[model samples]
Structure formats: structure tokens, C-alpha cells
Target: MSTYQYWQVKFEHPDEDEEELKAVIQGLFNYYEAEYGVRRLTSQVRDYYRLIGKQAPNHKRVQRLMHEMGLKCTKYNRRVRKYDSSKGPNGKKGKNKLNRRFMSDRKYQKMVCDITELKAGNGKKVYLEIIKDLATKQVLTWAIGQHTVFCK
Candidate 1:
């Protein structure tokens, strides 16, 4: 066939129906809340095709389509380290006066304190310290500050 005839035939009969495939991918991606990456999406697409008794598309094709459609997983890739109070310079270790006996018959006789670090909605760090009565399980005192020095 001549070049013009080949071009006409190619245009008339495309190798793959990309629009239909893209629609299916978009539906599945939305159905999954955009958590499925290319690998899982490709597997889902294969399963869908198998269910319909049609040939499954190649993984590379699925990946390319997802890239073109700007679909990406929302999950973070980095490991977020939790707050550790003992990571820095060592302070004089205090004796465990409670000795694992948290029960108390009288109020104010035994109390426990804890410090927690929190992130505000504006991305600012906030520290919260709480002192509680062991017997009543009530917060005796609580303080919130921008710095850890408030605990002192």
C-alpha cells in the first residue's frame, strides 16, 4: 500500500481505543479514592478486562495513561518519626516514686504528669502539659504553650 493509503487506513482503524480505557481507569481511580498507584491500577484494569472477556492492556500502557491523566496516589512516601522526649541530651533520671502503684485512696496524694507536643492548624508547634489526680482521674492542672519551657 502507498504511504497515503497506509496513513488513511491507520487513521480509520486505530490499534487501541485509548478514550474508553482512560474512562475506565478514571472511574476505577475515583472509586478507590485515588489511593491506587500505577501498579495496583494496572492489576485492577487487568481484572476488569478479564471479567468482560477482553484482552487486558499492557502495564506500560496503563502507566502512560495515568501519567497523562495526572493521576497520583495521595499517600505519603516518607516515614514520619514520632515525638520522642528522650532523644536529646540526658537529664538526671528521676526515681520512679510511683513504683507502678497508681491506685490512690485519697485525692491529691498521688498525681501524674505528662507532656505532649501538638501541631496547630496554622502549622505552629504547641506543647501541652497536664497534671492529673490518680484517684479521681481528673486533670488537676493543664497548660498550653508554644515552647517546652512551660513544663518547667
Candidate 2:
């Protein structure tokens, strides 16, 4: 026989207690599948027994049962990293010509360039490069293409 079958036959508990615990664990697992992890599920199980006035099982026991039954809360909150402006592998750290001065005496003296992504209705990826004249607040030139080489 397989190891699982062997273990099941060798160390079987009384039918009443085993079935009741299994049913309660399954119910709680289904109820909290979206939000609760093992820790919260353990507390919920304890709360359940407290309401029914029965002896609550240990949290580690609940965690073990959850592992055996393949019950898990897959969604976890994650923090996104902050965006950095000067991060790349171009090997050229060119000086900022504008020196953070947005205002310009002449029309094209201090121009700003930016590349933005565009999502079309057909789901194709397109990139748009825009050059703006800082003094007049007008677009000097704009180009759209599938490749980012337009910016380079």
C-alpha cells in the first residue's frame, strides 16, 4: 500500500471526533478562502470552538491541518518600489542641460522631452515622444512609433 494509505489505516482516530473536526475545518477553509491566511484561520477556529463551548484546538494544529488539506490564501499585499528617474544601462550620464530651470528666455532655448506609452483599441503597444518648448509652452515636435528608438 501507499504511504498515505498505510498511515491512514495505522493511526486512525475515533470516527465521531475525526469527522466533526474535518467538517468544521473544511467549512472554515471555504468561508475564508479569499482573505484569511493560516494565522487568521487558526484564530477563527478558536473563536468557533469558544462559541460552541468546546475545547479549541491549538493554532499549530490548525496550520498542520491546513497544510494537509491544501487550503491557502494566495493573495498577499505587496509594496511597489519607488520610481527613479536616472536608472538605466546606457553608460552615459549626460549633464542636465536645463538645470531644473523650466523657464526659458528664448522659444527653443530650454526644451523638454518625454516618452509616453499609448494603448490602442487593438491592444498593440505604441510609444509617443514629445518635445515641448519651455518658453512658449508649445509642442515643438511629436513622433509616435512601435519602438522606443525614436527617443534615442
Candidate 3:
């Protein structure tokens, strides 16, 4: 037989076992809501085979299958944009007296203050205001509350 004919016969037929394994992987991927990456998926697949009394496929094989099937975990892949304070009009810009020199010989010589927003366990937004000393790398003061704006 010609080399072309032999190649066609060898490569044309898909493995039945591989098809079933791909189906299993797809089912697991959906069951976890696409949060399982290759490592976790491989572990789950191994457990599944153990439950069924069959030998589990190699992790590399599972990875290759996942790549071919275009499966990916979405949890860590999400991009969250941070809040930018310099974008809108508000107050006069503070002079850069520090001139980017963050280091200081004394604790209170170079201090910085910032406000951060955090989410509570009940899904409510909490704002935290903190003052820190750059020399000692310690927090001087901190306050937490629900409102970002304060009125006198």
C-alpha cells in the first residue's frame, strides 16, 4: 500500500474511548460551572474513573483534551477595573511636596492616607480610611464606616 493510503487509514478513525472520555470531561466541566481548570479537572476525572472501576487518563492527556475542546476556567480570568480618584473634578490638587521621596528618618515625618472600599459578609459596602507612616511601615490610625463622604 502507498504511504498516503496507510496514513489515511491510521489517522482517519477516532478512538471510541477518547470520545467517551471527552463526554465525561464536558459533563464535569458543566457540573462545576466551568470553574475547574486542568489540575482540578484531572483530579475529578480520576475520582470518576475510580468510582467506575476504570483506569484514569493521565493529567497531560486530560489537559490536551481540554485544550482541544476549548474548555477554560473563568474564575481567575475575570478582569476587575479599579476606581480612579484623579479622573473627576473635586478639590484643589495637593502639592507634591514629598517629590516622590517616600522614605523618612522619623515615624511621622512621611505619612500617607488613603481610602479603600470593602464588601462586608452581608454584601454591604464599607469604606476604610487609613493613615500610615512610611518610615516604620506601620498604621498610625484607621476608621471604618459605611459612608465615604462626611458632613460637619
- Candidate 1, 72-113: lDDT as tens digits: 887554455454543444655566788999999999999887
TM-score ranking, high to low: 1, 3, 2
Q: Could you tell me which 10 consecutive residues in candidate 2 have the lowest summed lDDT? A: 79-88
Listed in order, each prediction's TM-score against the native is: 0.55, 0.52, 0.53
Q: List the candidate 3 regions with Cα displacement exceeding 4 Å.
A: 1-7, 78-114, 118-152
> How much is 17 displaced in model 1, in angstroms?
2.6
User: What lDDT tens digits, residue by residue, belong to model 2 across residues 1-152?
Assistant: 69999789757754575567767888987887646888888888889999999999888877777777777776554443332223445745656766777987787787777777777788566778888889999998899887666445
Poorly placed runs, candidate 2 (over 4 Å)? 1-15, 77-86, 89-100, 104-152
The lDDT per prediction is: 0.84, 0.74, 0.84
Across 121-144, the per-residue lDDT of candidate 3 in tens digits comes to 995678787778999999888888
Ten contiguous residues with the weakest lDDT in model 3: 83-92
